[model samples]
Target: MKKIVVIALLIVITGYVFAAGKSEAGAGGAVEIKFAHYLAESHPAHDAALAFAKAVNERTDGIVTVTIFPNSMLGNSQELVEQTTNGALDLVIPTEPAIAKYVKKFNMVGAPFAFKDYAATDKLFAGDFIKWVTPDLEDVGLKYLARWEYGFRNYTTSVHQINTPADMQGLKIRTPPDFVNSATVKALGGVSQTIAFTELPMALKQGVVDGQENPIATILTNKMYETQKYLSMVNYTYNSTHLLMNIDKFKSLSAKQQKIILEEAEKAGLAMQKAVREKEADQIKELEAQGMEVAYPDTKPFITAAAPVYEELKAQVGEADFDYYMDLLGKSRR
Candidate 1:
């Protein structure tokens, strides 16, 4: 009787351990990835993230699954990246400038007036840029997956129209809490007030800052147009959100699973890029209809005023890397 009881206890204990392992590993021992980003559900990136998750799961036949947390549900942009780095999270999509905090060389991507248009961006992002940054990302326990569109940063002001660099002087501008953005605004002669995106609406309403800069889609979706009276299409800097995964988490996946994830990420990124570019004009129009004045300022003076920002980037990233990046940018230009 004693032997039988011991045997029964052993079997039950073994079963419980097996069940717990299976639960942690997900259904059928599938690998589950948690992806988080700051974009709201209305943004195209969120839709693309959902589609990416769906396609990845289908392609892998339940061998892998991705769950997305949008609208900073996990944390803000900077915090999300930190969590992914420490392996507390599996994946995150953060703006390029945000990544520069971890890898300083990434600051080159945010150099003011670096990209002329979408064609230039498409060429660079599709080329060796990813390869160049891969090792650096790995150093910080991140694997760069793909580049998705954020859009060209433009200025919107409640104080006055920003037709020239001179107009930006002394105007308090709310910028993302990143060095590149703050430097860009300061170089353009505006006082940079770094603010978290989640708190921006209240800041604008409270007159904490006179104006802000963001992509048209973001402005429209976030209702920033309600706070600001003017939109200036200076296109000072082009921005992209990079999909990153924890290196250890990515390495734990089988080769086939990794390949499938990469392919789906690229496809989803391209989809997002296409959606953003196609809707930008309509988004700007919507902002105008919301009682905002739109202006296509002569960007030459603005570009010239932004030259100091490039110098600062060069100082931060070193001369050789900066030159190499510039060469890549030049070659990418159509």
Candidate 2:
């Protein structure tokens, strides 16, 4: 299966390159880049990506143009990252957890209760954290361009209201295929089932899982509220989205082009963060209008329950790196 997938990927890449060359020749020598993400068009990430594309084209004066594939038109999160790593895709903005599969230190941020809140997260982003993570990425043929927000992940369940870790006992909850998410469910005493984001609605509708957790944007955009009965604001984790590109492809670009790409990516990320912050309350209200009950549960219990995850992940990522990150996260809160 791996060999078959590689062969298929090569074929796709070869075909795209050839077709892209011909199309660009016909389009008066404009370079074309493909950007992909797995989110609905209504998603803030999608809107931000479109803005990035527009800004790039305008700044480059039509010398370059970006074609975006939202909702995983090219592939799921894992496949997209792999494609970017192999230079088959030009860019992708995947969740930090997905990126953690390639770069282990990313797991620190993906771990449950990693950052105190968005402000702390921003402080880490503004500091030397990206520099610290760059070597791991460059070693794997990728480059981190910008950080976008995925907002705080909260619980939504059809089974019951979750005010404390005890309430989650024996409940089956869906999580993405990531260790932090699974460990979080285990710590809260729930059964963890890895489900693709695209299939989560059906999974919840058919009772395959009793509930799931995601940011409010995802819950509202994907209409998960339609299937889930309650939204619990436990703020168990913060979801972070990062723009990544093939390091080789980025280096191949002219210095000016590379600068434009990086600048536009940062702008897009900030735009996304602003949009998410401004729209969250409205999104929750929309979920309520869709018949979902929203609750702001006391999060101390959930935070206490997830404490072990920090030690477990720190051991996995190495004590030195873990301590460095903790120091950064700790200072960020102040």
Each candidate's root-mean-square deviation in Å?
5.9, 10.8
| Model 2 steric clash pairs | none
Give per-residue CA lDDT, model 1, range 113-201, as digits (tens).
Answer: 88888888889877788888889999999998888889999999888899988989999999998777889889889999988999999
The lowest-lDDT stretch of 10 consecutive residues in candidate 2 is 21-30
Give candidate 1's TM-score: 0.90
Per-structure clash totals for the candidates: 0, 0
lDDT of 2 by residue, 1-334 (tens): 9999999999999999987665543344667888999999999999999999999999877878899999978888988999999989999998878888898888888778766667778887888889999999999999889998899898899988898899999999999988888899999999999998888889999999999989999989998977899999877888789999999877766667788999999999999999998999999999999999988888778888988998888877889999998887877777
Clashes of 1: 0
Q: What is the C-alpha lDDT of each candidate?
A: 0.88, 0.88
lDDT of 1 at 94: 91
Model 1: residues with Cα > 4 Å off, grouped in runs: 1-28
